[model samples]
Target: MRTSSGAGELLVELHRDNGVPLHQQLESAIRTRIRAGLLRPETVMPSTRALAQDLGLSRGVIVEAYQQLVAEGYLISRGGGYTLVADIAVVSPTAAAKPGAGPPRIDFRYSRPDVSQFPRAAWLRSVRRVLNETPNRSLAYLDGRGTIELRTALSDYLNRVRGTAARPENMMICNGFAQGSRLILQVLAAQGHTRLAVEDPSDNDLREVAAAAGLETVGIPVLNSGIDVDALERSGADVVLVTAAHQFPTGAVTSADTRAALVAWAGQGNRLVIEDDYDAEYRYDREPVGAMQGLAPDRVAYAGTASKTLAPGLRLGWLILPSWLVEPMSQAKLMDDRGSPVLDQLAFADFVAHGEFDRHLRRMRPRYRELRDTLVERLAARVPELEPVGVSAGLHVLTWLPADLSEEALREAALARGLGVYGLKPYWVSGDGPAGLVFGYGSLSRQEVVEGIDLLAEVVAALRS
Candidate 1:
């Protein structure tokens, strides 16, 4: 074992007669230590001469190993400066897996899109166009309300497609739906709003955001048509968040009557509605429903994201605020990271303006619809006992299990078989709900969807036995 001491130490054990070259062995040892997080980012390494002297190897071998590590991004070198580990070093297999884990689980967790289908060429074109056309001054710290170009483009797109009354001046670009919701809740809390009414069994992550923003959350039941307005009114919440076009975990579109009642409920007091139109573009059975914000723009704060339609990693979302919120929300946004990335905002603006965004959705809608259809059909055929609940829109469907089966037991069995399935119990605020599972099919292929369902059926049969 040969070790070199410095601000960062290198430990290498070399085989004198092994076929591998000394340089190769030294490079491998350093790479492994960096990946295992033993050699942290920015830690300076010993001089090549010092390391060579310590290991009884030629200086040329140490230099070759250091150069190789630098080329591979495992190390960084500057002129006349000691080599240092790259700042991007991360623990890999250790962070992602246990010591003796089984094969990768087939993840069916909902709300993820097929990232492989991302429009790379189109996105590259948009980014290139932005870089070419955008003025240098425009790239500086921008308005917290986002770039005027994107807001203008989004204003037109939302108005034309979603029936929103969005204006360039009234919208703020955010990191994503999660951050958008947090900003809104923070504004509401600052405005003396105490209670936020959310749909029961809604996205638990959003509920946690509401709590973090200093607003107490109250759950209102979600009926087949939509959120129970009567219960919302009775809950005495000053603000409400809803997925009116297509509710999550249930796929219930809010009826016209309920939309009216909700707007009316907001009109009666100092109330507001936060509409998370997360995935309203993929309705296959009929034309998608228009946004609820159109009916009552003054009372509704609408939020839309590029996560489901384009890709989540983009972290791009926009909020169409009520006129009263425009100033406060923009201020809050300014205080929260000085707004999202200007380059992404500009590229997205160009993406939407050139109709690339529309074309992308046009291409993806049917693909997602097919995935949803296959999952529903397979569930109905192989495990008829599990009734598919919401299948009309969105990337996932919720299936209610038979009363005799246990959600926990079935989920554990599915995991043992390397299948990842989520249950509705965790989404409920009370943590008590009917037995059901949410199957997200957007990220899986047609054959994978079939195989997943087949495996699930086997698990069900075995559990019954």
Candidate 2:
């Protein structure tokens, strides 16, 4: 058996005379290894000097290759001249199946945040500070709810940002929004709540989660103003979930009149309002709407997650529960996983307390806005009939398509063109809604967004013909 080191054992067959530059050839070879899982994540690579010397190439060539890979997220520089592979999903050699028979080269799926812009240095600093500051006894079981430091920090952060009257005692941190929803539903079901009403065109997984928790899910219509309050009242559900700031798929902001109506409706029936404040931070136009929890704190159970703001891999979410629901939700959280990891909670507290989180958001907003603008502009030029629905906020936008192209047809056409376009159909509960496409500009670059939409326009033309 032979063991391989990245520097000496790694194989690269660079072609100098094959019309490809040495740097590009080296970059492609390394990328191929990563895609094929030949080089695993965190695998340390040889120094530029060593690799260049071994390959009989200038150090500048290896440096250029490494830089390109880093920008593409295939590699990461760990500072102090250390480089390692990034832990991204490994691409299959036949990932796109001859370009048109498999997954798209450009994924426009709406669930991801712009992870490339993640503040690694800031996060590392926070982690270091937490490690240095956290007492050993603090590492032991303190509270199933979460570390008080995090809850305290989150309480203040939410108050300032989302306008929620969050209190440390009333907050419970969970794995993510999904877990938070599950626990809330479990507690509600245990308390004799039977029905949960959700937006008609919302995440299907959310409906499934409610159903799994033994709550009957009722689908209510979502108009331009937001969830139809009249329809919601008519559903006769004991609990309702809403994405008030920016609705999923459609991006409708819950209007003041509708907000009042929903709160009134909740008051009338003593129903619970589970406000999913998922992506309220990235508002490109005007001031962001405040969380509905603030308007009716006693009635609303506010849920938020770092999945959208930071990265999904963080698996950090918090719920600002009403006084009555805190103990039960906290107990439920305890039984679920004892508690979320303490290290992350402590580090996040430091991150928020030191204002680094705010700084990161401020830095990312402009870049994301740039990507959004490029996506919208290119789509308007290429596909004039595609109307972008929803407010200019969040990482994704829903574009209502012309009647000629069905959502499924458009999605398939886009896929065939190596462009991943998600149909709005799956988001709908009743399976009957207008055709639309959801474009997520979170991960892709501005140039990539433009190229993808242009390809999508061509796909639509072909489908129309």
TM-score, every prediction: 0.83, 0.79
Instruction: Give per-residue CA lDDT, model 1, range 1-465, as digits (tens).
Output: 123246235678999798999899999988988888888787878998888888899999999999999999998886775688887747676576656756536878888899999999999999999999989998788878999999999999999999999999999999998889998899899999999999887889978888888989888899998999999999999999999988988888999999999999999979999999999988888666899999999999999999999889999999999999999998899998898999999999999999999999999988998888898899889999888876888898988878888888988999899898888898787577787898998999999899999999999999999
lDDT of 2 by residue, 149-249 (tens): 99999999999988998999999999999999999999999999999999989989988888888999888999989999988878889899999999998
Which regions in candidate 2 have their CA more than 4 angstroms from the true location? 1-102
Task: Identify the leading candidate in terms of TM-score.
Answer: 1
TM-score of 2: 0.79
